[model samples]
Target: MAGFLLWLLLLVFCWPLALLALVLYPIVWLLLLPLRLVGITVSAVFAFLGALLMLPARMLRGRPV
Candidate 1:
């Protein structure tokens, strides 16, 4: 993948910073996990609201001739 290649390039160019990033990646992901879950929940709620709002219109549209 491109990310791995980029990281490899970084490792080749600067091992210390690359190692820091490698070590910090998991910690950063763990910190951001809750935000990601919230985003997914928000998106699902929005989708449910949209479907609920459109229900009547879909019901009235009925079958095509």
Candidate 2:
């Protein structure tokens, strides 16, 4: 993979920072995981509500809602 090669090159060129990233990436991902989940949940809830509110009009139009 190009991405792997890029990181491998970075590791070869700058081991300290690359290693730091390797160590910290998961920590950052874990820290942000809850926020990502909450965002997805909120978006889903809003989408469901919107579809529910639209259903009556869609039915009136005979649109096969």
Per-model TM-score versus the true fold: 0.90, 0.87
- Clashing residue pairs in all predictions, respectively, total 0, 0
Each candidate's lDDT (Cα)?
0.98, 0.94
Model 1 lDDT per residue over 1-65, tens place = 99999999999999999999999999999999999999999999999999999998898889564
For model 2, the local distance difference test gives 0.94
